[model samples]
Target: MFFAVIPAGGSGTRLWPLSRAGHPKFLHPLTGTDASLLQATVERVAPLASADRTMVVTGVAHVTAVARQLAGLPEENILVEPSPRDSCAAIALAAAVIAVREPDAVMGSFAADHLIVDPNRWVETVRQAIVGAEQGLLMTVGITPTRAETGYGYLQCGPLIDGGPLRRVEEFKEKPAADIAEAYVRSGRYLWNASMFVWRVDVFMAELARQQPELHAGVTAIAAAWNTPEREDVLGTVWPTLTKISVDYAVMEGAAEAGRVATVPGDFGWNDIGDFHTLGEVLPADSSGNVVLGGEGTEKPGALLWDTANLVVVPYSNRLVAALGVRDLIVVDTPDALMICPRDRAQDVKKLVDELKSRGEEGYV
Candidate 1:
C-alpha cells in the first residue's frame, strides 16, 4: 500500500494579500476550482491512498483551517508542528510516524500547493515511482522542463536503470542563474526537481539516520509518543531542537551523491504557482491577456481592465477593481491589503511581506 504525505506548510509570501501567514495559499482555491489546494491535493491522490492512509504535516496555527478543509481526514493524521522547522523536520516527522504504523509501506511526499493539469499522467508517474521505491530506491518525480525556469531546482539525470523509464539521479542542482538554467534545459539531461518523493518508510528512515541522525532521532522520539498524550509535550520539547533544513539539502542531495536516488521524468503539465505571473500563465486569460480571479458565477467580474494587457488581478473584496492603461502588472486586492507590482517583478513580492514585518505591520501581513 502507498501512503501520501502532504506538507501543508509555507505561507507562500510571494502571493501576498491573498496568501497570508494565517491563511496560506494552500488553503485558497488559486486554480479557479471550488476546492482549495490542500483539498485538491488529497483528492488527486485518492486513487493510491485513502484518507486513512494520507497525512498532512502543518504548523499549529493552521490546524483548525486544515481540519475544516480536509474533513474526511482523521484528526490524528493531521500532525501539527509546534513551529516551522523547514521541510526536513516536517517530512521526517511524517515518515517516522508512518514507520510506527506500517514499517514496510511505500510513502510519497508531495507539496500541498502545486497544480497538475494532467492527473492521469501524474498518477501513472507516481505509480512508476512506487515501483522504484519497492525496489529499495528513493524516488523523486522530476518534471521535464518545458522552458528554462530558474525559479526551481533541477535534477541531473543519468542513464535509465534496467532499460526502463526510471533513471538514476546524477545530481541535485540548486536554482541556477538564467544562463545556467538555459544551459541545463538545452542539455536535455536536466529535470525540474518538483520535490515529489516516494520511498519505503524503512528505507527512508535508514537514509535519514545516515544523513540526518539528529533529525531522525528527534522525530523518532516524537513518533514514539504520537498516539499517546505525550505527543504535544514531546513535540514541543524536541521539535525546536531539530536542525532547520530542507529535505533536498538534508537527504535527497546526499542520497543522490550516494547513488540511492532515482527519478522518473514527468510531463503532465505541472506548475508550482509560485508567483502571480506563473499563476496567470496557468489560468485562462481574456482576449486582452488579462487574468481575473475570485469573481466566478457572479454578475460582474472581480476586476475590470481597459487598455490593459497581460495583467493578473485578484479582487477578493467583493468590489469591482478597474484597471486602465496598464500592461504586465499584477493587482491583488483583499479586504485588508492591496498589492501591486510589475509582472516581471512577481518573484520579489515576498519583499513586500518582509517590509511589512520590518515596519511592524503584522495586521496587514
Candidate 2:
C-alpha cells in the first residue's frame, strides 16, 4: 500500500497576521480559494491514495485546527507533534508510525503548503519516486527550474543511471545570487530541490538509524507507542528534546554526500509557495499586470492596483485595498494587521518578522 505523510508544523511567520501561530499558512486560504493549502494538498494526494492511507503530522498547538482543516482524514491518522523540532524529526516520526503496521509500505512525505497545479503529473512523479524507493533507492522529486529562483536550493544532476530513468544527485547548493542563479539555470544540469521524498517505511527508518541515530531513537520510541494510550504522553516527553534540523541537512544531503540517492525529474508546474513574491508566478495576473484575489459576483472582493503592476494582493475580511502610484509591491490585509512591501523585497519578509520581535511585538507575529 502507498501511504502519504503531510507535515504541517510551520509557523509561516512571513505571512503573519493572516497566517498566525494558532492557524498556520497551510490552514489559510493562500490561493484565494475556500479550501486551504492543507486541504488542497490532501485532495491532490487523494486520487493517489485513500484518506485512511494518508497521515498528517502537526503540532499540539494546532491539533484542533489541523483536525478541522483536514476533516476528510480519519482522527486516528492525525499525528500531533508535542513540540516543534524540525522536518528531520517530523518525517522520522512519520516513518516510524507508518512502519508499525506496514513495514514494507511506501510512504511519501511532503509539506502541506506546496502548490502544484497539475495533480495528475504530480501523482505520476510520486509514483515514479515510489518505484525508485521500492528498488532500494531513496528518491526525491526535483523540479526543473523555470527561472533563476535564488530563494530555493538547487541540486546538480549527476550522470544517468545505466538502465534506470533516474539520475544521481551530485550536490545540493544553497540559494545563490541572481547572477549565480541565472548561471545555474543556464548550465542545464540543475533542478530546484522540492523536498518531496518517497521511501519504504523500513528503508527510511534504517536510513535514519544510520544517519541520525538520536532522532531515530526518539522516533522509534514514539512509533513503539503507536495505537497505544501512551503515544501522546511519550511524544510530549521526547519531542521538545529533539534537535531542530531539516531533513535535507540531516539526511538527504548526507546520503547524497555518501553517493546513494536518486532524483526523479519533476515538471508538473510545482511551486513550494514559500513566499508572497512566488504568488505572482502561481496566480494568473490580469491584463494590467496585477493579481487580485477577492470579491463575489459583481460586488465580489477585489483589489484595485492603479498605476501599479506586478503585485499580489490578498485581501481578507472583505476589505478593499487600493494601491496608487506603486509598483511591484505586496499588499496583504488581515483582520488585525496589514503589510505593504515592495514585491522585489519579498524575500526579506522574514527580516520584517525579526524586526517586530526586536520591537517586542510578539502578538503581531
Candidate 3:
C-alpha cells in the first residue's frame, strides 16, 4: 500500500486578495472545476492511496477548512502543525507517523496546490518513480519543461539507468535568470522540480536522519505520542525545535550529490497555478481571451471587457468590474482589497504583499 502526503501550507501571496491567509489559493476553485485545488490533489492520488490512508499536513489554522473539504478522509489523517515550520518537518511528521503503522509502505509526497491535467499519465509516472524508490534511491517526479520558466527551480538529469525512463538527478538549480532559464529549456537535460517525491517510509526516515537528524528526532518523538494522550503536548514542544528548512536543501540535494537520487520526467500537463496568469490557463476564456472567475457570470457581475484580450478578471466581490482596452492584465477584486497588474507582473504580486506588510496594512494582507 502506498501512503500519500499532502503538505497544504503556503498562503500563495502571488494570487493574493483572492488568496488570503484565511483562504489560501489551494482552497479556492481556481481550476474552474467545482473541486478546489486541494480537493483535486486528494482525488488525483486516491487511486494509489485510499482516503483513510492519505494524510494532509497543514497549519492548525487551515485544519478546519481542510477537514470540511476532505470529509471523506478519516479525521486523524489530517495532521495539524502548530506553526509554520516548512516542508521538511511537515513531510517528516507524516512519514514517521506512517512508519509506525507500515514501515515498508511506499509514501508519495504531493503538493496540495498543483494541477495535473492528465490523471492517467500522473498515476503512471508515479508508478515509475515508485520503481526507482524500491532500488533504495530517492525519486522525484520532474515535470518536463514546456517553456523557459524563471520562477521555478530546475533539476539537471543524467543518462537513464538500465535504459529505462528513470534518470539520475545530476543537480538541483535554484530559480535562475531569464537567459539561464531559456538555456535550461534549450539544453533538454533539465526538469522543473515540482517537489513530487515517492519513497519507502523506512528509506525516507533513514535519509531524513542522515541529512536532518534533529528534524527526524523531533518528528519521531511527536509521532510516537500521536495516538496517546501526549500527542498534542509532544508536538507543541518538539515541532518548533525542528529546523526550519526545505526538504530539498536538507535531503534531496545532498542525496543527489551522493548519487542516491533519481528523477522520472512527467509530461502530465502539470502547472503550479502560482499566479492569476497561470490560473487563467486552467480557466475558460471568452472569444476576446478574457477569463472570468468566481462571483456571478461575466454578464451579471459585469466583467465588461471592451477590446480586452488575455485579461484575467476574478470578480470575487459582488461589485461589477469593467476593463477598457486592457490586454494581458490580471484584475482580482475582493471585498477587502483589489489588485490590478499586467500579466508579466503576476510574480511580483508577492512583492505587493510584502510592501503591504511594510506599510502596516495587515488587515488587507
| Model 2 lDDT, full chain set | 0.83
Task: Give the backbone clash total of model 1.
Answer: 0
In the range 1-365, model 3's lDDT, one tens digit per residue, is 78999999998999998888789989987766668899999999988889888999999889999999999999999999999999999999999999998888889999999988898999999999999998888999999998898989999999999997999999999999999999999999999999999998899899989988888899999989999999989988998898999999889999899888899999988989888888888677899888987633333464777888999988777788998888999999888898999999898999999998999988878
lDDT of each: 0.92, 0.83, 0.90
lDDT of 3 at 161: 91
In model 1, where do residues sit more than 4 Å from their true spots?
295-301
TM-score of 1: 0.95
Model 2: ten consecutive residues of lowest lDDT:
293-302
**Tens-digit per-residue lDDT, 222-341, candidate 2:** 889877999778888888888799999998888888786788899998876677877666877887778875534536456766788888887886777888988788888888788888
| lDDT (Cα, 0-100) at 339 in candidate 1 | 90
Evaluated at residue 345, the lDDT of candidate 1 is 99
Shift in Å, residue 132, candidate 2: 0.6
Ranking by lDDT: 1, 3, 2
Q: Candidate 2 — number of clashing residue pairs?
A: 5
Pairs in steric clash, model 1: none
Model 3's TM-score against the true structure: 0.93
Q: Candidate 2: misplaced stretches above 4 Å?
A: 162-164, 177-180, 295-300, 304-308, 323-326
